[model samples]
Target chain A: MRYELYYWPEIPGRGEFIRLALEAGGADYIDVGNRSEEQGWGIAAIETFLGGEVTDFPPFAPPFLKAGELVISHVANILQYLGPRLGLWPGDEANRLWAHGLQLTIADFTAEAHDLHHPLGPGLYYEDQQEEAARRARQFISERLPKFLGYFERVLIDNPAGERHLVGETLTTVDLSLFHVVEGLRYALPNAMAEAEQEAPRVIALHDRVRDIPRIAEYLASDRRQPFSEEGLFRHYPELDSDG
Target chain B: MRYELYYWPEIPGRGEFIRLALEAGGADYIDVGNRSEEQGWGIAAIETFLGGEVTDFPPFAPPFLKAGELVISHVANILQYLGPRLGLWPGDEANRLWAHGLQLTIADFTAEAHDLHHPLGPGLYYEDQQEEAARRARQFISERLPKFLGYFERVLIDNPAGERHLVGETLTTVDLSLFHVVEGLRYALPNAMAEAEQEAPRVIALHDRVRDIPRIAEYLASDRRQPFSEEGLFRHYPELDSDG
Candidate 1:
């Protein structure tokens, strides 16, 4: 089935998470908002999707996926729905729930990362909130990063199968999500992530292993893998980074 | 099965949403953290649940419900799991997904409400972030509040079943959550919510109707239903509330 991904066109933003899964699975999908304006897919299309009158399943925000008649939103929820369908998660209900729990944690980390730059509010520009951002960045880099990373590291080490994957032995959407968090932290808090790597070696190793996955490798090498920028979640403000 | 909910005692906080459902359903559940300190239950117990070294299955944070072997975290996920078990959701898978989508949105709004006071970072004191909080509050009151409320209002209106409930004719966890958001917003952003209500009549009606549900009425009247406080998500900061 052909999947339609609705998100802001210019920025990879949250939509990239969905894109990674689709690309990794080689699933037939269309980035609806990214299509050419002449093809009736653009900013207006996204706005209409957001404000349209005929929404049976209205999404609070974007990074929503429409498959057949099912329109799923919320990144973690969307991933949960897509995981089994795309062979990105375990088939068991318990395992799926565990994976979802892990995904929610990743989402928490992602939200914190975003807040470091936009602590004042997403509706305002980062520059306007830089002072608050700086303060938030300190807490994020010092306290939250290590806490979250350490938890994941322990999860990996404590895994009955091994420390290779987040949930199950094989790769899952949680692994992809964990990799994204690591990559985001590296981009946004290079020094803190680098210093904390020793404590979270298993999580780091998982990141490396996920990068080696064939489809993921190809996707990362391709143009579709948008480079992290100021507009995205992991924006680099020099003050946010730590030496140790 | 007796359910054990692990969350901080005192404030209604995030745990109240779960409490509302359990109370409404007349389910046998224990507020583990609210129990006496000497009984290995309280804030310490909550911490143990959060920071424990359980490898079998771990909850990243509290407001998690432990039922049998299943320990569910993420308020929305917990509600989703409980919604079915408690018969608070439609049995159909697609409808369940939709209901979950609504819960997730409420979770999002709840997070935003928390951020209004702690906009700089969760680690820092509100006083340290007061300036930024003011700015963030303005955006939340003006933009996010209405956007979320409007979306839910639209969803209720668009529901093929009817507008009496969020999902269908019957009350679901989503309806309870929407009621919580409306109550929280009115407490937190009274003027703003009042102004926005003109455009979101369906959501207002749903909130009012949920309060009138027999079980819900009893729960609200009972001491167990903690009053909204400055310590909770919906803090009544006058600066944040605007008629505009």
Candidate 2:
């Protein structure tokens, strides 16, 4: 079945995570919000779902995947649904649950990453909360960043299947998500990430492997892949970043 | 089967969501962290899982569930696992996925509520970040809180099965989680929540309905259910709350 992904047009944001999985898994899908309104798909299409005109189970926000009658929202939830269907996750009960837990952990890390720029609240502009953002970014880089990365590093090291994959012995959606987190960090906190990567060589290797996958490589080089920008989750503000 | 829950011994934090489900479902479970060290449980037992001595899938934080050899982390993941096993969720696939989405939304709301008292970073004390916390709390009570509450209010109104449930016709884990959010908000932001409850009558009613569920009513009065405290997710600081 062809899937429909609804998210903001301009920014990659959380939608990128869903995009990576779809692209790597070679699933047939449409990026609804990115299409022009002239063709009947764009922000208007996304707004329709949120407007309660579509179905009773309205999404809290975008990055929702519409598969026939099912509209799945939340990054982890959408990915968990798409993973097994798209062949991005193993079909075993235990492995699927474990991969989902890891994906949820990534979701937590993504929220924290977004908070580095909007510590006062998402309602406030980054400029209005620059002081608090800087403070949060400092702690995030020094403490939380290393803690999260270190946890993943350990997961990779202890994987009974070896460090090649995060779950079972195959390329699951969890590995794809880890790759995105590392890439987002490298873009958002290059200095700190450069130093932090020393402890997570296996994670970096996993990121590289995902990138080199033919479909993922082609997708990254194509126009569908949006560039990292200030408008998205992982914003790079030189002032808020440090070598620490 | 006896389920094991591992979370911080104190505070009805994220773990409370899981606790409400277990208690409401009348599932046999052990509150591992709350047990004494002499009983071979407590923080030490929780730490053993985190210390990588238990399983390869180490949870990033607490409130993880250990069922047999499988360990599940993240509040939503754990509930999604327990919901069906304990008969708290419908057996159908569509309703289960929908319930999981709603649970994830509650998790997001919980994170934002926690940020009200610790806007700068979770590592910093509320005393140290009071200024930023105050700023965030203002926006939270005014914008974020209403948006979330109103969204759930709409969901309750638009539910095809009627306003009695969030997912299908019967009570599910999502209903229990919504009860906790409303209860926590009332305890943490009484003045604001008292006024805001006006807009979301259905959500408030749903909260009341869940609280009156026979098993839940008993759990609420039992010592097993911990009291909401300042150390938990929804901390009540008079300076950081308002009736907006």
Candidate 3:
């Protein structure tokens, strides 16, 4: 079945996690919001489903993937559903669960990355909360960025199967998500990422390796790969980057 | 099999979600962090597991549930595993996935609640970030509190099975988690919750119903139900509360 991916046409945000999985897995899907309302695939479809009582399982937000009768939201949950279907997840249940756990942790990391720019709340403009964002960015660059990246490094180092992959010998959805996390950080805090990479070489390497995967490499170069901007989860603000 | 749940002893936090599921399902479990070192179930065990490479799937934080060979982490993932074993989750795959997506949404809500007080970073004490927390608490109480609670109200309103439960006419983990969310909100923001509850009558009613579930009612009164404190996920700060 062709998947209908519903998300804001603009920001990569959480949808990027699912987009990367779909692209890397070579799955057939349509970016619904990118299409016209006449085609019956638009933001209104998402807004309608969200605002009206259309489905028994309603998504709290966008970046939801619809497969046949099932509509799965939440990056980790969506990936968990698509992982095995696309042959991206391991066969074993425990490792699959581990992979899901890793993705959930990545979700937490992603939210924190967003908060680096929107420290007050999403409703307020970055300018309105620049003072708060400045202080929050410091803790993020100095403490959180390393803690999250280092934890991934340690996971890579401790993987019983191997360090090449987060879950097993083969690539899983978590690897792709972590790859995006690396890209997001580098985009948002290049100077800090340069320093953080020293401690998280494995994490960096995994990010590098994921970039070279044929399908992923092609996807990265293609128009499908959205550029990081101020509107996305990871935004490049020179003031927020740390030299230390 | 008896499960050993590893989480911070002081706070109900994320662990409470799993605890409610286990308690309501009548499953046997040991709160590892709350136990004495002499019992081989202490905070040291959790620290060792996180710091050292013991399991292939080592948890980044506590509130991981160890069920025989499986070491499940992340509140949603841990509960997904226990849901079936404890009979707290729905039998069907679709309903189970819905419960999971709902739980993930709850996870996001819970993080926003925690961030209201720790907007700067978890590394800094709440007192150090008092000014930033003040700004965030305003947004959280005014905007996020209603948005999240309203979303749950809609979910309950839309549930085809019945509004009594979050999923197909049975109390799933999401229901218990939502119960805790409402309880936490009420304890943390009594005035705001009272105001928000008016708009989310179904959500409030579901919370009330989950509380009165025989096993849950007993657990609430028992010492097993940790008291809400400043150190917990839902902390009571008079200044943070809004009369509106």
Please give the DockQ score of every candidate, comma-separated.
Answer: 0.72, 0.84, 0.80
Q: After best superposition, candidate 2 residue A38: deviation in angstroms?
A: 0.9
lDDT of 1 by residue, A1-244 (tens): 9998988876667888888888878899988877887887767676776775546777878988888888788898889888888889987777777788888888888899898889877898987878778888888878888889999988887677788987878888889888888888888888888888889889988999888989999988987677888888788877768764
TM-score for candidate 3? 0.98
- Give me the displacement of residue A110 in model 2, in angstroms: 0.6
Ranking by TM-score: 2, 3, 1
**Which stretches in model 3 have alpha-carbon errors above 4 Å?**
none
Candidate 3 lDDT, B1-244, residue by residue in tens:
9999999886788899989999999989899888998878788889878875577777878779888988888999999888988878899878878889999999989998888888887889889988888889889888989999888988887888878888888888999999999999898889888888899999988888888999999999998878889998888888888865
Candidate with more favorable, higher DockQ: 2 or 3? 2
Which docking category, incorrect, acceptable, medium or high, applies to candidate 3?
high
lDDT of each prediction vs. the true structure?
0.83, 0.90, 0.88
The top-ranked prediction according to DockQ is: 2
Candidate 1's docking class is medium
TM-score of model number 2, chain B: 0.98
* Model 2 DockQ (Cα-based): 0.84
The stretch of ten residues in a row with the least summed lDDT in candidate 1 chain A is A46-55
